[model samples]
Every structure is written in C-alpha cells, then in structure tokens.
Target: MKGTFPIEKFSHLSTPFYYYDTQLLRDTLFEINKEAGRHNFHVHYAVKANANNRILSIIRENGLGADCVSGGEIKAALKAGFPADKIVFAGVGKADWEINLGFDAGIFCFNVESVPELDVINELSAAKNMVAPIALRVNPNIDAHTHHYITTGLNENKFGISLSHLDQVLDHLSELKNIRLLGLHFHIGSQITDMDAFKSLCIRINEIQEHLYQRMLIVDIINVGGGLGVDYENPDRNSIPDFHHYFETFYKHLKLRPKQKLHFELGRAVVCQSGSLITKVLYVKEGVNKKFVIVDAGMTDLIRPALYQAYHKIENITSDKIEEEYDVVGPICESSDCFGKIVSLNQTQRGDIIALRSAGAYGEIMASQYNCRSLPKAYYSDDL
Candidate 1:
C-alpha cells in the first residue's frame, strides 16, 4: 500500500525534496518509549541517522537521549536542547578536540573502541583534571546476517575491540586513573530483522559479564546497540518496528545486574518509516525493450539504492489511470543512478509525483553535491 502524501502541497514546492510525516514520527517515538519503558531501558537516538534540526528538536522533546558519533553531531544535539548528561559520544577516531569538547560539555560517557582510544581519552581527560566516564565497545563477533558493509561485530571489522583483547584492555584500564569504565556496548550491524542475532548478542554479553564478574568487575550499564530493522518494502503496513519483540528478546535472554541500566542506541528504526523522497518525474524515455521514467532526484539526494543496492518501494502518487512497468531512474551522469529496475507503478507520466518510501533514516542526512546539484529541502507534515 502507498503512504499518504500531501500531493497538492507537493505540487507547489520544488521537486526532489523530502516529505516527513511528523505525526508518524511522534507515534513511532511513542511506541519506542512504551516498549523500552516496560523494561526500564534507556534509549538514545543515534543522531547519525537523521540530523535535521527540526527532527532533532522533535526527538529531543520526546525525552529520548542522543547518541552521537562526531563532534558536530554532539553540537547539533546540544543545540537542540538535549541535556548534556543524556548524550553519549561514540566514534572510532574521535579527534582530540572532540574528546575535549565532550569533557567541556560534561557529556555522560564515551564509547571507547580501542585501547589506544582509551589512553587518548584518559590523557585528554587528565589534562583537564577530570575523570572521563566511558563504556568499552566490545566486539562480540556475532554475525548480524546483514550486508557486509554494515556488519560491524565480526572480528575483521574495525568497530569495537576484539574479545581476545578484552582482558588485556581491562588490565590496561586498571592503570588509567583519569578514565572510569561505566558500561559495555555492542552493535552487530544495521537493518537487522532477525531476533536470533540479538539473542546471540545477549548470550555473548552474558558470557562476557560472567567473565567480568570473575574479575569482580561489575559495571553499571549494558548498552546493546540498536539494529532493529523496519519494513522498508511495506512501510505503510509496518510503520513502526516490532519493538515489543525486539526488547522482549533482550529481556528474556540478557541477564542484567541489580541497579544496572540497559541502554540502546537506535537510529534507523526510530525515523525510517516517517519519511519519503518526493520527486517529480522529469521525462519519460521510450527504449526498444522497455520504458524509463527519469526522475529529477538523483543518487545525490538518496544514494542507498546505488550505494547498498537497497530497495525502497516506489509509487506514482499522482496517477491512477492504470498499471505499467518502467525502469525508474535519476538524471545523474552515472549509470548507478537507477532507483528501481522494472518497477511496477500506476501508468506513470512526465509530471507524476513519485514517493520513495521509508527514507527518513539516512535520506536527507546523506545527501551530497557530487553533481553540483542543490541539496534537497525537507518539508514536514505539521508545517505543510
């Protein structure tokens, strides 16, 4: 089924823009709170997903914390009114300035990815005469069964510290006086639909906890990084992810210590379904074998289809004449600018408005100016 769009409003605006349903976003946040609150789990929205100013403000207003991977995202989160105590800085290569920025802001904790990173944070924190709170991002090596590019928990991925080095890292942590280990963090990958992967992550975390317990190391938080995937093909049917099952999987499998908090960094699942890449058909080219519907929006606006071979349900929202199949493409100079091959839609025309479903997560945030094209502007339903 097609998502509801403000066709009249879209017609008045420029082509190749993002249309966000704020009500749907709010509803999704409500479901996240309702489910996570059941287990008293703390959730921080991963700011790398969609960092639009208004979107960030709405998410902050909903009481969810922020999980940032860069200094700029931290600044954005702070500018949006998220409490400093509720933001967690995480990244593999955090510059010295970024670490200092975190210390200056007194952010909650840093998810340290390596022993060297730990030492750097320690040194930086010591320079400021402060104790830096940190969480060790351990690599559990669990396969998330997702795309290779997004899979981060494997031993080969350069994400978290390897399990084999955890003990050594812990031993080294004992020597650092300016850094305090606050928790453990794990993230397998993104767009994961399988609950077993998370269950596996829980089992691995339990084993790690037991090992830590043997060393009398009891941390205060267990942050199972978010990989909950939404239904991209059927966005209207499953607008919000299955948070009930996702959280329940952790509650049943993962064992938590008393007074220990469970944290989650969710990015895509929180915002993906409420957005669509709205573009106007620029031209229709008749090929020998098939027809092509060229859109004004290129890979610059939404690159997932070209980058990851990702699929987004395409619909001709302005037409209802009949059904036909056409290869939907963009006007980019590259051959990889295709959106969908042999996509079936209502008899499309040159001026029909097309809605690319489930783009709220990485759509506008990842837009580029590769072809010197202007960045797509975003319009929210509330304002429209």
Candidate 2:
C-alpha cells in the first residue's frame, strides 16, 4: 500500500516539514486497542516518541494511557487530554521538580529506577501528605538486540534496578511510608524486532516473580515496557505493526497472577510509520564517482540517520522518471548529515519533493535547531 501524497497541496507549502497520515494513525491505534482489549491489557503511549499536540490529542481520544519520561512530557500529556490517573512517569534521573509535578498531577505510577529516586519520591509524597504509587523498574539484563545506544535492560545500563540489588531495594521500600509499591517494570530496549527477545523477557519476569512470591511480595501490575519495532523498509506493506502477535506473545509466555494487570509503554511501533519528513531537493550535484542529491532538510530536521545510522526509505514523489542511484545528502555542515547512500529514486532534480518514510516516531520529536536551522513544522493528512 504505497502512501498517497497530495503533491499539489504540498507544492504550495514550504519544504522540510513533517507530514502525518492521521487516518493511518487512527487505524494503527484501532488495531492496537482491538488486540490488547481482547486480553484486557493496558498500553501507555510513550510520549518521547512523538509529542506533537495533534498526535497526542488523537492518541488521547483512543483511550490509551500516557507514558512520560520528563516533566515537560507529563505536562504535554495532560494538556493533550490524557487523564492524570492514566499517566505513568519513568526516567533514570528525575529532578525534584519533576517528581513534585508527577505527585501534583497524581499520575498512576512512577517507574522508579534507583534507590535515591525512591527516597526523593517518598520525601516529596510525604511533603504533600500523599502516598505515591510506584513500580520498581527492574533490569532483567535481557539484550534487546538493538542499537547499543537504545538498549536499556542490560546490567551495565543505568536505566533500572539490577537483580542483585532487588533485595536491597525491597528493604528500602519497607522504610518508605509515603511510597506504595504498585508493581514491577521492565524495558529491554527499543527497535527490538525479534519476538524471541520478548519471550526471553517473559521467562525472566516469571523467575523474578517467583523470587518475589517467595518473599511474600505480590504486585498487582506487571509493566513490560514496549520496544516493538516497525517495518521501516516496507512501511506501506506493513503500515500497522503485528499487534496481534505482539500481544499474543505476552499472553502466551508471561505468567500473570489472577486479576493482575499487564502494561506496556510502546513508543516507536505505535507511531513510526504514520509520519514522514517532506523535503525538497535543493540541488542535484553530480560527482565523478558518485551523485549527491542535496535536500533542504538536514540532521537538524531528522537526526536518526546520522545519530543511529538508521535507515528510512526515501522516495522522489514528484518525479515519474526512470530510477537511478543517488546519494541523498542534506544541507548540514556535518559530513554525517547524509540520509542514505546509493539510494534508488526516480531521476531526481531540483525542486523535487522527497518523502523520508517511517519517521513518525523519533523524527520530529528529536528535531533540533542545530546550524540555526528552523524546526520542521508538522501537517496532518486530514488537515491538508
């Protein structure tokens, strides 16, 4: 299913902006809710993925919870209509003000990552004469088989409490009167395409659960943080991710106690395919050995390619000419500002509209004003 672009309408607008297929986004959310609803699972949309106001509004309308990692994200989720009770805050280094904000908002839970954070939250909750609900983010040490930078569940990663330190954390929990233990949270990594990695996590979680059971500490929630990957290379073919399989994986493998709720913090897989970075070809510079297709958008607009060496399918939507290989480079001073190498696109030329596919997740949210370039504005398909 090749995505349809309103080239006529796009021609009148400025280049280097984000284009979101709202219909596709709605469809994706529908599929996610349908599958998860069957098992009565809870999903929190990780706002770090894409915090666009419109995007957050649409997601809030779909009845999903919000997963925030910062004070700003918590506020954004609230402003976008997500219920405070349906929000969960998670981060390795949460400041005092951020913890106070979460407490003030009365979010569902704080995925506490360290003992110091737990102490701060307990102290803050006590200050307000409240009991802060929290879930210990346990590091299962399972490799998500993703980029090293994005992996969070490993033992060395500073994201979660290690198994070796779980007893100590539990001991500290007993002393915190204002902090209530709600459950356990585990996030292996992001961009995890392998289902077996998740299966392994379930097994690990079961083992951890057994240990907790032995200690007579039973939790009512089990939040397996989301890392479901999307089909970046073939977005049109697999626009909506395999939610059925993803949900079923947990249903089949995870050993949940009766009436215990399962939670997920999905970011990329939920919104990655519904948005694209639209850039106009500024110049087609031909070199002796290679051809460079320079575009106005650079690393400042979409940094995944340069930062993570990520791949996004680039298409010359404005041309119907014969295909040829061209290096898609951006107008940034940095040499790493390139999108792809030897990309196959229609015989490209200046003013050609290019669509960087599968960028809805980390694309716009991570945009920067580097080189003093203006941030990319976003337009929805319905609005266009």
Off by over 4 Å in 1: none
lDDT of 1 by residue, 105-221 (tens): 989999999999999999999999999999999999999999898898999999999999999999999999999999999999999999999999999999999999999999999
How many clashes does the backbone of model 2 have?
0
Lowest lDDT sum, 10 consecutive residues, model 2, at 1-10
Q: In candidate 1, how many Å is residue 376 off? A: 0.4
User: How many pairs of residues in model 1 come into backbone collision?
Assistant: 0
For 1-384, candidate 2 gives per-residue lDDT tens digits of 346899999999998999999999999999999999999999999999999999999999999999999999999999999999999999998999998998888899999999999998888899999999999999999999899999999998989999999999999899999999999999999998889999999999999999999999899999999999999999999999999999999999999988899999999988999999999999999899999999999999999999999999999998989999999999999999999999999999999999999999999999999988899999999988
